[model samples]
Target: MKKIDVIVKYFYPLAAGIEINVRNVYKHMVSHGWDVTIHTSTDMPEAKNSLPVIDHLDGMNIHRYPWRWYGFVPRIDWAHTPAIALHNFNIFPHSWLLIIVLIRRTLGMSSPKVFLTPHGGFTPEWRTFSPLSRFIKKTYQEILGVHLINAAVDGLRSVSDWEAVESIKHGMRPDIIHIIHNGLEREVYTQIEKLANQVTTDQVRKLGRYLIQIGRIHPIKNQATGIKALKHLPQDIQFVIIGPVTDPEYKKSLDLLISQLGLFDRVHFLGVISGVNKYYWLRHSVVNVHMALWESYCNVIHESMSQGCVCIVSRGTALEELIKDKINGFCVPEYDEVSVADAVKYILDSSHARQILAMRKRNTDFTRGHSWQNISLQVEKMYTTALGS
Candidate 1:
């Protein structure tokens, strides 16, 4: 069987949305009789550099190269061209890998068909990036990166319809675009639900009448807005934030805001969690809030819904496709405090609890199509199509 080369910025000892999605899908593919090798960095820019090493996880081969000099450089030795090269997260490693492949092809060497998955990084909303970074990225794309992505890639894999439109706007050929939504491992959720139903964990119950938001603590997550929404709710309503602090300054700002609002006791920040502990909170929280500036498709929303937790997401994101306001879930018009507060208040009010529970019961039926096993089959078909192209 021809092997597929997977290039990502980081793998293992770190958990991000893109990393989780790649891990789950490829692991499924491997089990289904596909050969997948992941080429990734040992650490991200924030972590200390280390020597390169090779590792394997659940039958998937991983080559972890030292990410010295801020993860901007990558060292890869391709003994032979792979059948397909799928690049996730279009940053450093992807750019460098593309350059190397293009150079090899130019020298009459074997070249694998390339696939690009920007993972929501190329949407027009990306124009909101900090001025200095935005200027540098736009200039690079206009001068070289855009052309490389358009001319060299065999296909552009999109996780949502909105993402597909964004890629087309950025010069990728529409014919080569494929929309493959992210998948959920139902078995994982089944196990979690079993644990969550047994008893409310003391740690989660201690927070009392809280709402939860699970993701990185970054400005793009729009967490400050969620904090401000607390003003509109009853004082007893605690707000629990669960995720790794990706940005210290942003966390400080959140802390400062918590102090300013005098919500020291009411607001709680529980750093990164997974497994049964994660599901416990999701299963019990009054609402799961995910109001981000832009998200390709948030896995947490599906996880929360699967656990029978009511979800309130921001409108205009890919999440809009999965949620229906006043039906399966709630969608706020904007990420502002007023909008979020209104959505929360509506769901938390005593009168609405019955309706919310009704929707919760229907969540599993609605999300049955997202099984990761089925999604891997769709990915396999796409791989076949890309190789044929």
Candidate 2:
């Protein structure tokens, strides 16, 4: 572990799970005088033409390459990094980089000690896709994904125990998998601490009474569940949705459903918010309802809880680990419409005000303990294990 470099195909500052994980964790590593470098893609849709190909900041070497097709990036000949970490989700860098490692190992080229953190990469949920898409995923996961990992990867960094099963299904060794969850940024908690006092009457009026679902609009995310839950809540409380529409068709279906229910006025969609604006909305909201079908790990859950907002998350996924069925917060059975509605209504009911406040207190205490500084130490141990030092 002489030099620590991370590879994530799509890297942005202070956004998304993988990007934020890299920014927070590696910055701590850099402060400790560890050699931290990040290799990422120059395909930032938000920045368009603004990002430079090469830059250096926060005591790290930032290298950006043009992404051509299907997570493909042109390789540059630079000094080798002995230890490399791959941040993965459904696709991109991990899937593509795995192929590179396979080819390199097959050609008898020198291989780095690679560790992979699979944030929901190649999971069983892909079976829900269309036949052609399913075939492509199956072929990749069973054939390429497994072989590449077995050939080159030295260890696995899993965010939760739930994902260890998914990693094993893809043929990763269980003993080598490290269960290290993501953590909240210190600044985020700083903002929450500032809100310990009551907000003014005007400030409360401005924020409005609402429940929020913050994530990309996708069918797999099950945003429709939130809409259905809204039908059970009171009329004054609108459902605030803040995330980009990654799937327009799904968004259209939600619009149609809202029209059918005649609740157009009660459902507000504010796409892709960040920084304090997003936090203010979450902090002042009535509650946060997230019913995504599957997740390797969810950062929004931690963010919502840290702000003392009660969360109603789905069960049988990584969310269960976060919202421990009334231990900290609530977990409705996933896709059970009646159960979901009942849970939301129960928390919102005036009779249960004391109970909900207790839950909020427990949630904030639990979430506050998981800061990035704590997570960095766990990640450094994973790196050391992977490097066998």
Candidate 3:
């Protein structure tokens, strides 16, 4: 069987969005008689011990390489320093592995076609980057990425059209860019059905008639705007934020803002929720408002929509692409509290209950197209095209 080569920084866990994409797409590909070998880095921040160097699961071979967290530079304890005040530059050793594997294939030493998924990595602009970080990003893209890495890749997968456009602005070719959105597995909806009969989680029951956003606590995810919008909302409707605090300094600022706005009581944070419990909150929320300042794609909104949760997202990124501005759901500016408040108000108003129902139906119907099976077919087609047949 022919194989596909996917080179990325992380792959083992089913935690992050990028790995989830690989697992879903390639898992389905295996069912369609294709094999995959994922080349990934070994920097597991959460693991107590190193994961195995090689393993097989779901009929896919995995090769893990040793990787430094900050490459040649020292890893900053992001908790102590403000993110904007610091910067570090480092080379991605994955590029070396990619070039070597691609050359081997070119010399008829290997058969797999090398595919690259940027996975929210190749951005023209960095939302949270420090000054030196921005310079280093440009240097890497112009030197290593454009001249060598892009030339060696058989295909480049961008999760959103917005991501594809930004990558082109940096170094990638438009012709090689494939806009494949992240998708849902059958397991996602099945989990919802099993949990539907059970009582909602205590967190959900405690904050009845609430809005929720699920993503790491960072400036990029823009949880502050959700909190800001609450001042304009009724007292009964609160906001719940779910996810680990990846940015401690940002969380501090959020806490301060929460106190300043007198919204400390209304905004609750449930860190790191998963499986049935996570979906329970999603299902019962008045709406899932994810106004992330930057994203290649918003997987949270996709998952929420799958479980019949209405959403309000920001425009200009893939969030807008998923939501059609009050058609399926609402779209507001990333930081516009008034627009967000208005959208929430519209949803809660007794007059718009019928409208909300129609939106929920449309959202679920739209999400059906993003099934992992269809994503696998598209991915298979990309690999075939790379083979020049």
Among the numbered candidates, top TM-score falls to 1
lDDT of 2: 0.75
Q: Could you give candidate 3's per-residue lDDT for residues 198-252 as a string of tens digits?
A: 4445556667799999987878889999999999999888898998766788999
- Model 2 agreement with the true structure over 184-274: per-residue lDDT tens digits: 8775756543543344334445547878888878787788888877677777778888887667888999999999988898888887777
Candidate 2 least-lDDT 10 residues? 192-201
Residue pairs in candidate 1 whose N, alpha carbon or C atoms collide under 3 angstroms: none
TM-score of 1: 0.90
Comparing 2 and 3 on lDDT, the stronger one = 2
Q: Local distance difference test, per candidate?
A: 0.76, 0.75, 0.73
Against the true structure, what is every candidate's RMSD? 2.7, 3.4, 7.4
Which residue segments of model 1 deviate by more than 4 Å? Answer: 44-46, 50-52, 68-79, 84-86, 89-91, 187-193, 196-200
TM-score of each: 0.90, 0.85, 0.82
- List where candidate 3 sits over 4 angstroms from the true fold: 12-14, 32-37, 44-66, 69-91, 98-112, 169-171, 191-202
